[model samples]
Target: MSKYLLNKFLFTVDRDPELVERYRAEPRATVEWWESARANRILGCHADESSTWLCFEDAEREALAAHDYPRLFELGAHPFLTLTLFIAMFERDHPPLGFQTEYARRLAHVRLPYPDIAT
Candidate 1:
């Protein structure tokens, strides 16, 4: 596991309990990112029991480190496609800028999980 992404968060939108079930009842949408350097694929995503579950490769909790995590976390949220940029940038045990203190404050909620990527 990448130290930068120790948390594995699986997002489920459970606004409408029936929505989740309905989403799962039919075919799911497949999404891919063009910016991805490797195979970053979202097999399927749909709602069930008031929740929309996204089935992804490995970005479930890894996305928590996203600088955009907060932005992507608002209600009525949808899954994102930025793992390509993340996997392409992170190095083991380092955030590129190292252990930054200021970013922690100014960008606390908007910090990129891997500063090595788009800092």
Candidate 2:
């Protein structure tokens, strides 16, 4: 799986407030649209500079589309990026610290030997 691409998606989406809201509200559509329109567009560069080789694997796509952060972690997405973006999307739905606690609880089954995150 392309961990770099996955992290790139998280990092990019997390940085843009509008995209963040879009992703939070319509994850599948956001992921599909991003894969089609933004995946290969080099950040801060002109559209002509876009690359042609970046795409999410099916698992990665589905995980992201489902807002399955735990699946993302298992698929080697960076934890910080995942957590930060997820917090932005979901924290408001809970009481203070409740989302974080839920996040931890959801990941409690993960063992020490986490999946390799290196791209």
Candidate 3:
């Protein structure tokens, strides 16, 4: 599932204003571009030091491209990272707490023994 890479995508995109906008506006394209261009680039390291592996699985890619937060949670993406990035992208469209409420509601079906988040 590459939870680490998924979390990395959330974390990285959340921290950058432009990228956040880009992701919100062009999810599929952004996911594709990120996977192709940045997924293997080690953070805080030279480009040449990039890792050779770190691609999202097909389901993971689809979940991200679709902004399916509930699916992301099922895939073991870190909740905080997902929420933070999601809030940034969607909170503005709702009244205060509305998006959060919706987020929780959408994930209400998740039961105990949550998916393992450890990378």
Candidate 4:
């Protein structure tokens, strides 16, 4: 719902199908890898024990499990890649109920049918 630059995490996941699959297959390992990369300065993330970073990581996990795309966006997920993130997570076994559940969750926060939509 905001005009923001491409989100590093979602952008990366969007571009790399392999990475998306990896996250689908190994959420814990993927998070662990990110933590290692950030801690070792492999990624641009600062090597600090910042509570914000930890919170984001935890939020990411929760978002994935709950199929709460808006939650990810609130935690700095890319708006453009929001749908893609949902698709990636549920690609293997698409369940109607699961999709509906996620859709309802997102719909609750959606502002009308226009400008409030995430850019």
The per-prediction CA RMSD against the true structure, in angstroms, equals 15.2, 0.7, 0.7, 6.5
Error of 2 at 119 (Å): 1.4
Per-candidate clashes come to 15, 0, 0, 0
Error of 4 at 9 (Å): 1.4
lDDT of 1 by residue, 17-101 (tens): 4433332332122012211211222325332222233233344232332434333332112223223222222322356654233
Model 3 lDDT at residue 74: 96
Residue 40 shift from truth in candidate 3, angstroms: 0.4
The C-alpha stretches of model 2 lying farther than 4 A from their native spots are: none
Off by over 4 Å in 1: 1-67, 74-106, 109-119
Ranking of all candidate structures by their lDDT, best first = 2, 3, 4, 1
Off by over 4 Å in 4: 1-6, 38-68, 95-101, 104-107, 110-119
TM-score of 1: 0.18
Tens digits of per-residue lDDT for model 2, 33-104: 999999999998999999989999999999999999999999999999999999999999999999999999
Candidate 4 residue-wise lDDT at 18? 85
Per-model lDDT: 0.29, 0.97, 0.95, 0.54
List, residue by residue over 1-119, the lDDT tens digit for candidate 3. 58999999999899999999999999999999999999999999999999998899999999999999999999999999999999999999999999999999999999999989998
